[model samples]
Target: MTDIIETYLEDFGPALSGTISEHLEKSLGISAAAARKRVSRASGNIRRLGYVTFARKARFMYLENQFGSPLYWRKLVDALFSTNSAYGYAIAALIQREGFVPEWEFPIVCGAPIKQSRHLSPATIMQRLKEAGLLQTIQVNGLGDCICIVQSEEHYNSLAADTRVRLITENILLLAVKDWLRKLGIVSFDKVTIRSSTHAPKVGTFVWDLTAPSYLGCLIKTGKDKKVKPGFVAADVYLGDTITEPGSRPFINKCKTLRALRNVGPCMQIFIANRYEKEAFSLLKQNGIMPATPESLFGEDVAKGLSELTSVLHDAASHSLDPERFERLFAALGKIEGAANQLRGTLFEYIAAEVARKNYSSLVRMNQIYKNQSGKKAEADVVIITDNISVRFIECKGYSPRGIIPDTEVRRWLQHNVPVIYKAVKVHPDWQNLDIKFEFWTTGILSDEAIAMIKTAQVSTKATRYSLGFKLNQDVYDLCKSTKDKGLITAFEKHYLPPY
Candidate 1:
């Protein structure tokens, strides 16, 4: 650890505004700007600060603090980490032990930004420390961010005043996992992957929300744009250096509006969620958040867009379709609308993702596009139009083309039209191996009968056109594998049964 950072940590306590920079420069005689820039990463949570960039920006990033009281993160964070390889761990630990209190603090350190390399990684080092049993989780307020402080005595005997120096450095290797490794042109089938940096990080990409008082998230994507702006989409992403072991979903369910924008089609591309596009754009411009040019923000009119989508589906009632087909789309739209209303704030993304994951297409005033080179406008329950000759959708329970469309539904429906809209569409003989034909997907996750129906479908024009099946990609795990919260798991297992 640098002597400057060590001394600075001694003098520093919880932070707020320019107090951090001002105090550091005054005491250390360094440039004030450098101090502010350094300290923000070393101590602040970008989600709470609204300015410090950590990772992708989204409605969650923008609105995470709106509904809940800020966590008194010091206790929880303190309990979860121990000063080991960190630059100022010993000094900071001493100051914390002294119970130093800075008056009128705004929890800046809890929500600080980052601009450091591996040896200086604040977040990564902490997670690794926790995993190595150097940290412990304690519920301080009985149930809040004010959880317990470090279990100092737990490992006191395990350490010495002078432990092996090389061994200490070995503990810091996990910090490297926190660094974003840039890979250019990882995929050549389409556009290149992009990544945003700690400053002005992009939103709606994969993010890591640290459920603590110093709550911040690590926004990750494929491209090399290092700013946190909203309205972006990508898939096949996991969190960075999580406390959980490797291969877990490193993302939280962004809100409904953003959820509406993600297209988990067969290709699994295009993940968007930042309030609404227009609002996000203006906010980004106003906040000096630079996205990779042509950024789309979330619209403020999500509700209206949803209503219009339903009306279009309602219009389908009179189009060239069978009574059963009409019934399916109509019912599906109603459920989505109902689900949208029932979950106005939280889990909108979860519901939407579940719906999309179960089926690729929907019947709502869905943004239609050519599903393949065959020029067929794909439909949905969960619809996926892929570059490889295939197009598909799911049919959920009680949803059909002839169901009721609700009124006054708020929230903008995402424009989920496949990229090659109105272009040559290809169809595959089989969905996993479609040889070029329209693929109709309907509900299958709910019943064995539904899946069975798909296996015995007729392919001629005289057929029902839509099929039923329960097919999931290899990446989809039981969501259970992703979380390790004992209390949450216990509660879920105690009551709800897992879906087979």
Candidate 2:
């Protein structure tokens, strides 16, 4: 199931929806788009079908059909054809210039690299070619032998003249290389590597991510052999015989974040962990600013930084004889730091994650329970358990005055000591308040007092300043109390409640 979903994601990033997508699965063996794409394709009205409805809810859209109807399929096919007018234009240009369409597979067989424009896919282009009936497949004995399906066509007719194909060919090659170059964030080809490959169009491109505005890659393998490696000769002055051939690339202008913060105020940082994450953190540290999530990306430092900053701000405002002075200073500092954040975009993630976590359900809502284990020691902040048909975890947050989840607690959970990270981030009034949620999940039981306790707990101003955990307002407390007292679970389908 996961594989099918991932396959869909790989094929279509966004423009996926509705029932015609289903037609593709049934007719083309491609599952996972909405049934409506076929409709959108046909009528240009995209919402005709999809799991966005109740029938397909159980199946993730990416794993579902494109659309549920056939009329929609025709629409989609027509849309694809109408959209490729540019391809036709280019082909027509080439044909006119050369005075011929060049035996259907002539260009490909004679050796030409094929890649789609940035907004399109090679597969989509191939599909268009199939629709135009202009493609002629052949059995090539070498590297680029995709799938052997020999072609036989008596006569071919194209809407445009001969010049389209030639012009399109040139454009395709240039665009493929340009897109590849963008991946490496480079603008100049002078400092590039181009090598031949055993494949039909043998050429690969590379560049630095930081050095270039965008990272694009392309390899045009044109022929078969031991003489080629789909390799390229780059003008990386420091480049050795190979791209990754240590010392072949630039010194990766990696400056630490801490170091970059030299001129800035205190700040927080989280290291997402992989090599890239570490490199990012290193860059921040190098800049001389506070990198919050240390130890691990979400380590003690995050909580500490928040706590420290909160305290510093609140303390200064509270203790100073002239509070106005501190307020003015703080406001000025906030502007300066906000500007830095605008430039970096890292600090916003913490706040964004909090917002997203609340609005996002699914795997994210599972944050309600986190799991961990302990062999010989007790864990702090959480607990875990499992049974025949269910698994449950409890997280206890110690949101005292400076209210924030400690990194030690995160480490504890990673060590199987704590149950989850969110619970630890919340500043609930009573520990027992949440204990009942765990009981409800595991035993299918809920205690009125426990329900009331959690529901009644109010959000602390301190905790709100940090993590965006739900505030357990009065309405929730009452709702839980009423639900528990009425034994709504027992009522099941017959249950009904007043619109409080």
Q: Across residues 1-500, which tens digit of lDDT does each residue of candidate 1 receive?
A: 13443344334432343544566688778896677666545522323233222222211111222212223234223322322223123213322222111111101111121322223333553454345333333312101111112444323223221121111111121111111111221222222232221112223322221110111132323334664322222332111111121011111112221244443111112222222245433443343223221013223333333333333333332221122432332343223323322222111112223334333433321222234554333323234454454455322222222222221110001122222331322243344444323222211122444333334433322332333333222112233224443332332232222335
The candidate scoring highest on TM-score is: 1
Give the TM-score of each candidate.
0.20, 0.15
> Model 1 compared with the native: what TM-score?
0.20
What is the C-alpha lDDT profile of model 2 across 1-500, one tens digit per residue?
Answer: 33433354335532333333564567556545543433233322122222121233321232223432232233332332244322332232223222122223222321112332242223343455445433333322111112111133211222121222222222222223334454444434444322112122212211211121212234223344523212222211110011121111011111121113233222121111112234534543564423332123223433233233333333322221222432333333323222222211111112122222233211221112221232132222112222222222333331211223344533343333222333442333333223222211111122355444334432322332222222222222233344442322222111112224
Candidate 2 residue runs with Cα over 4 Å from true position: 1-74, 78-152, 157-189, 192-500
Quote the positional error of residue 135 for candidate 1 in Å: 8.6
Q: Give lDDT per model, in order.
A: 0.27, 0.27
Superposed Cα deviation of residue 32, candidate 2 (Å)? 21
Local distance difference test, candidate 1: 0.27
